[model samples]
Target chain A: MTAADHAGWEVVIGLEVHAQLATTSKIFSGASTAYGAEPNTQACLVDLGYPGVLPVLNREVVQMATLFGLAVNASVARRSVFARKNYFYPDLPKGYQISQLELPIVEHGEMLISDADGNDKRIGITRAHLEEDAGKSIHEGLDDSSGIDLNRAGTPLLEIVSEPDLRSAKEAVAYLRKIHTIVRYLGISDGNMQEGSFRCDANVSVRPRGQQELGTRAEIKNLNSFRFIEKAINYEVERQIDLLQDGGTVVQETRLYDSDKDQTRSMRSKEEANDYRYFPDPDLLPVEISDEYVEAARATLPELPEAKLQRFVAEHGLKKDDAVILTASRALADYFEAVAGAVDATAQVAANWVIGDLSAVLNRDGKDIGDSNISPAALAGLVNRIHDNTISGKIAKQIFEAMWDGEGSADEIIEAKGLKQITDSSAIEAVIDKVIADYPEQVAEYRAGKDKLIGFFVGKVMQETKGQANPGQVNQILKAKL
Target chain B: MSLDKVKVQHIAMLARLKLADEEYASSVEKLSRIVDFVDQLSQADTSDVRPMAHPLDAAQRLRPDAVTETVERDRYQQNAAAVSDGLYLVPKVIE
Candidate 1:
């Protein structure tokens, strides 16, 4: 069958992002929230559901939730309710998790995502509320007994829901990236994927664009990487399209993305709302957020990534692509700004070096800019050396390579290696004279009006000086002798 | 909402549960009650109200472009029932 008409088929994508709140202890208990702790040692009586235990809402968790709401420009509910979600698993010693059901702390908001073309798309935020996490189930060896890890139990999780506003896998990834940036900028979560600090569950559905009837949607769970998010959604969309083309109806259910196979497989029949038997949690009291609290959180929010990206373009004279690359992460953006401020001689040059050479090295080495041996000041020092002609561009590249190897400062490396550019016309002229005397055939070729011999002469001079001679001086000396 | 015996058996198998006949009879009755209570939720006039997927209204968090961990394959596979050449082994049903 021909691909579903764009005018007819519409892809509705909603994301449920789970961010582990940056807290030292569990949400309702004093259990350590540290990752990679010995399996059950982190568990406490409260986390293990001992009788007579009560869940005291962590104040820091509330503040973190409020910070996220303020960052998203969402409304903070004056009062919210926590409810128990009932389910059975070996990892869930409590038999139920304390989650917000009826009333959530944060309400509706919108996130503006800019596409590659600089067009802004607004993704709708439904709610962001706090909940305690369930422990993990490790199904490793025994067929009859699965290992249980309670380290994650009672961990504070802020589950953010989005409206089905994303239309493509790329948009879904962009939305995830924007959310990731905002949360990290707000300092609410560490957002580490490998540690399961931040995870995504995507709800994907394909429907006729103008059709009132909605197609069944599949929820793809536990995708942590942006690449996987895009690939999983794209694959799911194709699978749904193929099923419909083969005269099959899409089934609504939860599925797991097999990253190795690059496919989504049905996990189980999707649970409806009533399955959980959700009711107001009696052990906890209703959370009351004051106007002052919301206002304070709003005031404490730092400038968001999108705002910083815009400022980078408007104020720093950076290209949109360069701005996007620099502001992709707060660390990278801060590093760029530090270097840019140091070398105000040219902002574009600074951006180019960071986004081009620096990014290339980091990507090639599989290291983040923060992990590079070249610090912001050191990078700025190298750029300044180039600008002041203390080193040629080629020499600067060589120095940068050494700097990345954890060698001492740019100046030290230049001095130790004797890589400083020789800009003196006399020095260049002497080398050029030796080259003209040695290559008489090239000299005659130049005298016979073969202008290309000039290039040969310049190359000879640069070779004689071990790439330390200035290209401009060599060009001037060669042209003068010819 | 009635949990037929076949449906009960199917759910149990899907869950990888091996149940006795006596347990199956009791579970069917108990599960029917639970399902009936859940079916009542369908009666709510949620036509206008949007179904909420999560309680919170926040976005995803991103990590720095750095490697934070390394999974030592041999050590990780130590817990597996069977492993070979950096791979986990499972019973082959295809053959």
Candidate 2:
């Protein structure tokens, strides 16, 4: 529950996400756009804004913006103009940043996000415009001097703005994750938050529950992670509610979320808001995209996250939650489909193993599905063994661990360790007889109306066979004997 | 829309420029004239006119996505006033 529940206020949130486009060079300059490069190495004369240099548009950036617009079902403007937003900062060598103002590339798009109740909530995408990124300023360990790295300068970015439609922090995260999945599916960005490839700024406000007008908003900037976004919005919402309860008005300003302190503080007041002196950039011309261009780009779009999730449920007959988790990432979804096709396992069983054990191991090791050591074929082999009763699910887990440790394939490990299930009726009968003899007192108790003691006999049978006996057969034989 | 000495000083501060006291008056006058000239365009009725962002009617020209330039850290950093460890050093920025 949110603080709004008690305070009788509702939280409203919108997100502005800046995703660095996946391009080999800077947007305007012929400079390498590779991350982690030596400082200033990628800064060309145009990037540095030399006196006589002008910007030429990067074609891939426009295509990427169009592709995102198509993915989100947005209207791709046929003509978009670039404007110069004037500001002065050390990191920005140019006095102004080239961005979209009056005319953006994409507008009026909507995305469907699954809320906490598993209901689809549509979030309005206000606009996604193209812009250039600023460089970095490092202020650590400098002895009153700051280091400037222009490597990120001139990098192409798509600033996707959202309408203030989210009611809670969880919804905001869901929206963010949906966008992250879409971008990754499009292969337009690495979507690495830590590496600053995808960055977020949240506009948060709170008002009385029945109030129609929105309260003043505070924009929390540079939220790089999903956890931070949720935490920061929650904190900001609480801060606003408390202030309003005490008859204080929420201040409209820019705040920075200090992750270490778990709080937000004022970065700049409205008075410090830059005029920006926005005007059309004279150097670069307006971008014109044709219908055919958009159609071609649309044809190349991969199956989006929502469609994939629906298909995973419809075709695979998987649980909705399981399908959502399996289709969270494209690679994991592909892995599941491959394993399901290779083995004779039911969709339910396949989903359980993949979402249960495989995800747990991946999470524990801090690895992505793409980095898994267990190949899809090997996992399918293991599942096939379980299907054929060569091993029970419990015993297969041990084989899975051995496989993860590079012991061998599932079949090879089972053969080497002699861990196959004892499904033969005669062999299981022998184990059950010994178990009944050893548990004679419990058996007498069971026959004298202690039906619960059957579990004790089953345990003994399992221990006698070292958990290799088929549990179903053991239960059947034990019930008959009793 | 109007320029004055105080507003000029604030602009200079935002731009990170230092102007002598004697130069403020002249700078304010020059900027005011430019603004006044641009303000004249507002007098003409533009309700039916479409807004234009660029003088040229050409669309944006796009280049193929490829790394066409090599790293030139030393040469690029040579343009900075001060540099150390492949970074451009400036006066400490608090935030």
Best by DockQ: 2
Off by over 4 Å in 1: A1-8, A115-118, A270-274, B1-95
- Per-candidate TM equals 0.83, 0.95
> What are the per-model C-alpha RMSD values against the true structure?
7.7, 2.2
| Cα lDDT, model 1, residue A442 | 78
In TM-score terms, candidate 2 sits at 0.95
Pairing residues by index, what is the TM-score of model 1?
Answer: 0.83
Q: Clashing residue pairs, candidate 1?
A: A127-B56, A127-B57, A128-B56, A128-B57, A129-B56, A180-B60
- Local distance difference test scores for all models: 0.81, 0.90
lDDT digits (tens) for residues A66-151 of candidate 2 = 99999999999999999999887889898889999999999999999878788878999999999999999998778979999988
Model 1's CAPRI class is incorrect
lDDT of 1 by residue, B34-94 (tens): 9999999999899898554335542222222222222243454455575443333444312
After TM-score superposition, the amount by which residue A82's alpha carbon in candidate 1 deviates from its true location, in angstroms, is 0.9
The pairs that clash in candidate 2 are: none
